[model samples]
Target: MTATVPTSALNLVGKVFKPSELRFPAMPPLGLYIHLPWCVRKCPYCDFNSHLAPDSPLREVGTASVIPLKDARNPRDEAPLTHALPVDLQRRYLDALIADLDQQLPKVWGRKLHSVFIGGGTPSLFEPALIDELLGAVRARLGMPMSGEITMEANPGTFELARFEGYRQAGVSRLSIGVQSFSDSHLASLGRVHGGEQARAAVAAAVQLFDEVNLDLMYGLPGQGVEDALADVNMALGLGTTHLSLYQLTMEPNTLFAAHPPELPDDEVLSDIEDAVHARVAQAGFERYEVSAFCKPGHRCQHNLNYWGFGDYLGIGAGAHAKISYPNRIERETRHRNPQAYMDEMLAQARPAEVRSLTVQELPFEFMLNALRLIDGVPDAYFVERCGRPLSDLQGALKAALDKGLLDPKPGVLKATPLGLRFLNDLQSLFL
Candidate 1:
C-alpha cells in the first residue's frame, strides 16, 4: 500500500522527481514479476531462465529422464529445445506481454501494485485463456493490481492439473505448486515430469482451486534420507496448504546437476535433513518467514514480502529481473534472455533492456542482500524506507554485526542472529 506522499517532496501523482543521491521516505510497496519463460522438462537441477517449450509435447518426454546420478547413464545430456515457436506462441507472447507492460508504465508511475509474482520456466506452462489474457492485461494496466496478490507458478504436469480450475477463473489469486519432491524416486531423480501420483494430484487440485495455496518443497535429494526429508515435510503438511517454499538441493552452475554430480545428502545427512525440516515446519503451525519461506500466519509472501522488504519490482518476461525505485536512484532492469530474443526486441518497439544505476558502492550490499533474508530482519524503518541510505549507513557494519553475535541486538530490528541465521553467507558478507 505504501504511498501516502510527500517524503519531503520527491513528487508523486503530481510528478516531479529526478535528482539523485538517496532520501526517499515513503514509496516502497510495489510488486509484479511475471516471467513465464516456458518449461516442459528442463530440470536436471534447474538453472531457471527456463526454456524447453518450442511446442510442448513435454518435448518428447525428456526421453524418460533419470539423472539422480551417482554414476552416469546416457540421456545424451539433454538440454536443447527452443526452435522457432511462433505460430502465435501464446498470442505472440501475450502481445509482447502487454507491450512489456507499456514499457514498464513510466517506471511505475503513481504506484500501487503490492504483489503479482507469476514466476516461470513453467508458469503453469501458460493457458488459462493465456492466464485470462494476462490478468486482463494486468487489470488494464495496473489499476490496483488485480485487486492485489495474483501469483501463479504451477507444475505437476498432468495437463497441468487441468489448468487449476482455469487458474482460478483466470485471476489466479495465488497457486505456486511445484511440489519438488513427493518421491517417485525423488521424482525420477529430480528430472521431474510429475510422479508420486502427479504430486498428489497436483496438491489435490491445487487445494480445491486456490485461495492462497503454495507448496514447493525440496531438500537434498538423490536418494534422500532423514525420513526422506520428513516424508517431504509430512506430505506437505497433509495438503490443505497456505504456503511453504522450502528449497535446498543445490548444484547450480550451468546445471544438469552441475554436469552429473548428484549423490546428495551427506553433510551428516544434510544436517539431519535441515534439522528435520525445520522442526517439522515448527510443529505444523509454520511461520519461518523467509529464507525459503514458510507460512500460515496470515500467509506471508506478498510477492516475497515485496522482495524481503526492499520493495518495488516490475520484471515482465523472458529473463525478467527488475528492481526499480526513485526519489533519487536505484534501478536494475534485465529482459532479453532469448524467448525469440525477447519476442524480437520487444515486438520491435526496441527496448530489450539492460539499465543499471545502484552504486553508492552498490547500495549497502544491495540492502543486506534482501534485508538479511529475513527471519525477522527489517524495520529500523526499512533503512530510511527502502535504502535511501542512512541507518547510519551501516555504522561500521552495524558495529561488526553487533560484535559478531551476528546481529539482532534487536531494539529496532535488522535481525539474523541464530548465529546470523547460521552464517547466512557470513551474515551477508557483512554488508559487503
Candidate 2:
C-alpha cells in the first residue's frame, strides 16, 4: 500500500538527521527482479498490472504453427483466449528490458547479484528461446554468481514439457508455478484459465524439470470450507513441491470483485481454514518462515529473503520497483506503470516515474516493516547496518513493545512475540 505524508511529519520529536549523517557498515546483498506484464486474459479478481494481449495467431503448446482453437478443443467451451505472442513483440520487449537494466547498471556497478526473479502475469507465455535470450543478456551485463538462483513464474495454461526443459537448459534453477487451487469449481470462480487437470500436469512437469519448485495456493474462496482448503494444500504437497505460498483471497479496491464482492467464507471459517492449513503443512515438515510462505528445510526463497531482510534489489520492466541503498542514504525507484510507456521511456533514456529518499524518521518504521515479517525476525545488527541507525534509536519503541508483550526480550536479536505476530500491524505501528 502507498501512503502520502507531508514532509513536515518527518520532523519527529523535533530532531532531524541529514542524509550525510547516515552511513552503512557495508552494502547489503543485491537481487534482480524482471516483470512481464501480459496474460492471455485478465481475471476478474486480479489487481496486478496485467493486460490481455492484442489479437494475434493462436497456437497450442508444442506446435510450431498456428492452429484454430476449435481444431484441438471446442472453441466455445474455452474462455476467449489471445493468440501466442508475436515473436517480434517478444523480442522488442526483451530488448526494452535489457535497455532498462543497462540504465540501472551504474546504480549497482560493483555488486554481484545473489538471486534473480522473473515474475509476472504468466511469464510462461514467452517461448523458451526468448527466455534464453533474456537471461543471456542479463548475464552479459551483470555478474551473477554461479550459484545464484534464477526463478521464473509459470502458469499451468502455458506449461509444456519441451518448453520447461528448454528453460532448465537456459540456466533457470527454480520454478514457481501459480497453481492457485486444485479444485475446478474454485478455479472457475477465481477466473483461472486452466482447470485442475492442467494444474496437476504442470506440477508434475515442474518437479521433473526443476530441482526447486514453489506452488502458489489460495484459501477463503467463495463457498470454500476448511476441508476444501486443506484438500488443496494436501494435493500440492503430494506433487513434491519444496515451497508453498498460501494466500487468502482478497478483494483489493478498484478490482471487479471489490466492486461486486463474492460471497466468501466468513471469519470463523477462514480462521479454521488457516489453522488447518498451517497444521497440515507443519505435519508435512514445512516451516512457516513468513506469514504466507512455507518451505521445507533449505528451500526458502532467496529473492524474497533479500526483500524481507531489507537488502537492496534492482527491479526492471514495466511497473517494477527497486530499493537501492547508498553509503549516505536509501532511495526507492519505480518505473512507468504502462508497458508501452515504460518501453518508450527506456528507448528515450528518461528518468523513472518516481524516486524518493527515505527520511530518518521513516527509516525505523520502514526497516521494521520488512524485518518483523519474518517469523524469527532479524538480528539486531541488521537494523543498525541497513537503516544506519544505532540500536539506541529503537530503544524507546523496543522497551514499549517488550513491555506490551509484542516483542521478545532476547538481547542480540529483534523478534516479534506470538502476540506480536498475531497483531503485526499494531506492533509495527509502535516504530512510527
Candidate 3:
C-alpha cells in the first residue's frame, strides 16, 4: 500500500509545478475494462486470475465439495469442460458488477470513454442475456459517447451463431475468440476445451455475424514445429478474421507449466518459427502493428490501442487493475482477486481498494513499457504530453540508445530500431 504524494506543493493544475514534482498534463483518452473472473477450467500455462466455475465438479473434503487446484491429475489431460454458470449465479454476479461500477464512477466522473472491453476468465460462458443486461446497465449509469467500438473476449468452445447475434444486438461491435491453435493435438496440449474443427466453425460463424473479429493463436508449443505454427496462422487468415494475436507460449511464474516444466522449443527453433510466421502474415496483408498483434488496415482494436498508447482506463471487477489520472497525479487500482469475496465486498457497499499515485521517479520506465512496444513507436511530442516531461530530461539515455543503434535516429519519432524490436527487453530496460 504505497501512499499518494501530496498535491498541495503543486499549484499549477495543468503543468509541472517543479522539477521534482509530477505534472498535471491534459487528460488522455479513457477506456473501460470489465473483468468476469470465471472460466470453464484453468489451463496449465495460463497465469491469469481465473478460477473454476461453481457448477464445475469438485473434490469432496469432509462432506464439502471444493474447487481446489490439488486434484493432482495431469493438466494436459483435463476432463472435458462444462461452459455454463447457472442462470441464478449469473444474476448474482451481474448485481455485483453494477455495484462495483457505481462506486468507481466518481473517480472518472464525466469522462467520455474512447472504448470498452469485456475480458474474462470466460465471458461467453454466461448466457447472452446476461451480457446484454451488463452492457445495458453500464450505459444506464454513465454518459458514454455513442462510439462504435465495444469489444468482448469469447471462448470458441461456447460459440453459437444465435449467441453471437445476441451479442451484436447487445452492442458488442468486436469479438476476440480464444482459439489457441487449430490442431486437435495442439489444442489438447494447451488444455483447450474447443477442438480444431470447432475453432474453425466458430470463427467462420462469428465473421458472418460481426464485421470485425479477432483470433488468438499461440506458437512455440511443447513439440510444435515451424510448419505447425504456419498451419495455424494460415487457417486463421483463411477464416476471414480481421485481426490475429500470435503469442509465443512462455511458462510464466506460478503457472502449472512453470512447476511441471514442459519441453518447450529451444531458442533457435523458436526464432525460425517466429520469422516464418511473421513473414507469412505480412505477405497476407496483415500489418504487425504491435509486438504480438496483427491486423488489416482500419481494423485496429481501439480498446487495446488505448492501453499501448499509455492512455487512461477504468477497470472494474474481480482481480481487475486500472490506471487513472487526476489534476496532479496518476493512480493505480486493483480489486479483490477471489470472485466470491469480490462480490461479497462490493454488494455490501464496501470501498473497493486504495491506490498509490505513481511517483515522478517511476514515470519514465512506466511510460516506456507500453509505448516502446509499438512497431512505429510513439512520437517525441507524445512523451511530453502524456508523460509530462520534456525530451531534454532523457538526453543521456536517448543518446546511449542511439549510439547503440537500439533506437531510430529519425527526428520527431522515438521508435525502436529493427534490432531494438528484436531485443525489446534490453531496449526498454535502458529507460529503467
Q: Rate the local accuracy (lDDT) of all candidates.
A: 0.75, 0.81, 0.79
TM-scores, one per candidate: 0.35, 0.90, 0.89
Model with the higher lDDT, candidate 1 or 3: 3
Model 2 lDDT per residue over 120-235, tens place: 87788787898998999899988664347999999887766888898899889999998889987787677676778878998999998898999999999988999999999999
**lDDT of candidate 2 at residue 328, scale 0 to 100:** 86
Instruction: Please give, for residues 1-432, the per-residue lDDT of candidate 3 as tens digits.
Output: 011222331223234347765454467678889998887668778889888887754321221122132332223354433334677887898999999889888888878878889998988877788899998988887655345688999988677788888998888889999998998777767767667877888899889988799999999987899999999999999989999999999989987777776778999999999999999999999998899999998888878877887878888889889998887778888889888899899999987666778877677778878878888887665655566655666667788889999999998677899999988898888888
RMSD of 2: 7.0
Model 1 alpha-carbon miss at residue 361, Å:
35
State each model's C-alpha RMSD to the native.
17.8, 7.0, 6.4
Query: Residue 337 of model 3: what lDDT?
Result: 89
TM-score, model 1 to reference? 0.35
Task: Estimate, for each residue in 159-182, the C-alpha lDDT of model 1 and write its tens digit.
Answer: 355568888887777888888887
Q: Model 1: residues >4 Å from true position, as ranges?
A: 1-24, 29-34, 42-54, 57-80, 103-107, 110-119, 122-188, 192-219, 224-268, 272-306, 315-379, 383-407, 410-412, 419-432
Error of 1 at 316 (Å): 3.7
The segments of candidate 2 whose C-alpha lies over 4 angstroms from its true place after superposition are 1-20, 56-82
